[model samples]
Target: MIRVHIARQFDVRAADGRRLNAEELHAEGERLMQSLLDLEQCNDDFCDSVTATDADKGTVLVELLISDETETGAFEKSRTIVRTAIHAIGGATPWEASADLGADYRPRDVQLEYV
Candidate 1:
């Protein structure tokens, strides 16, 4: 299991180029997050649970908890899936997102064997 944190600030505007009010802006963020969770499939296991919070004016903080039984590298794969989903919802690429496994931090090399 792994956790990913993604935060983004949006410029909420309507078709008439009018800024959305606090309620409208919040609703838009909620709608976007729901859309992301509704995707059937993208890369690997989709996020099992997600939390979206209005950090501040036009800013939303999205935290995703991802887990998969089929894929060992679920963390990496899920990150890619999240990015794609965000883009689909008109969200900016989460280039600053962070993902970590548990608390220990270590770099390891991997070797794949195929026969």
Candidate 2:
């Protein structure tokens, strides 16, 4: 099993292009985390479990326990699962993501920019 820790910073904005308040941002972060948990429940073959927490304002920390035979396979699957969870929470965008694959493995810094 490989443990993947992902940190994401979201600059959430409303439809009118205004930044979201602290309360709204917190709610959105909770929603995003719930989405990830739901995805893990559905895709048991790729992931063993998922947990998320609010690191700071506009930032979320997600830890995914992945069950893959190889390190490369785990990395690839983690990327796909994270992306799917983000997309599931429609309208949440313009965020940056980075991943840490334990102590021995070099951290993978993956960022997604949406317009």
Candidate 3:
């Protein structure tokens, strides 16, 4: 089995020093995560989970758990799902509002087989 952990982050502030409600933001994050799962076939052998936490410095961390039967297409599927979910959420690319969901980390070359 392959278990992938993705962290999507959102900044709670605007340029004017305004802040977003944490509860509401977290809910939206959760919804986006669910949307990603729903993008896949229901019968697919994947176990998904989500978590939202505070960075203690005014940012929110959205963590995703993707447990799949194998490593094939895992990275691509994740990108596709997340990209679609972002469009559904705000009519814009998710990258516009959040940091790299995975940052500089990627699956080990041996464990991930795209083909």
Candidate 4:
């Protein structure tokens, strides 16, 4: 089995073009983390664990551990799972996400925009 570490950073923003206050930001971060955790529960075949390491300054940091037969499969699966979690949250617009895979692989950057 291949173990891959994925870190995703999300720049969360309100739909009305206003910055979210600290309280709102924290709530949003929690929601996002919960969404990921929920997904992890269903995707046991590939996802090993999901963690919300930080949520502050209009950004949410999520770390994911995925195991698969190949590195490419793990990376792609991680991206799909994260995108699904983001979409599941809903309401948050113009979300931007970038990811860093662990040391052996080059970082895979992804941008997500909700219309």
Which candidate has the highest TM-score of all?
4
C-alpha lDDT (0 to 100) for residue 25 of candidate 1: 62
Estimated TM-score per prediction?
0.44, 0.56, 0.48, 0.67
Q: Candidates ranked by TM-score, best first?
A: 4, 2, 3, 1
Candidate 3 residue-wise lDDT, 1-115, digit = tens: 6766655555544333445356655565566566656654553533453535353444544344455665545555555555566556542342453342321111121223221
Best by lDDT: 4
Model 3 spans with C-alpha error above 4 angstroms: 1-3, 10-19, 40-45, 55-72, 94-115
Model 2 local distance difference test score? 0.50
Off by over 4 Å in 4: 46-56, 91-115
Instruction: Identify the runs in model 2 with alpha carbons over 4 angstroms from their true place.
Output: 1-19, 46-57, 92-115
- For candidate 2, write residues 56-102 as lDDT tens digits: 43334445666665666766776677666666765433343223211
In lDDT terms, how accurate is model 3?
Answer: 0.47
lDDT of each: 0.45, 0.50, 0.47, 0.57
Residue 4's lDDT within candidate 2 is: 45
**Where's the lowest-lDDT run of ten residues in candidate 2?**
98-107
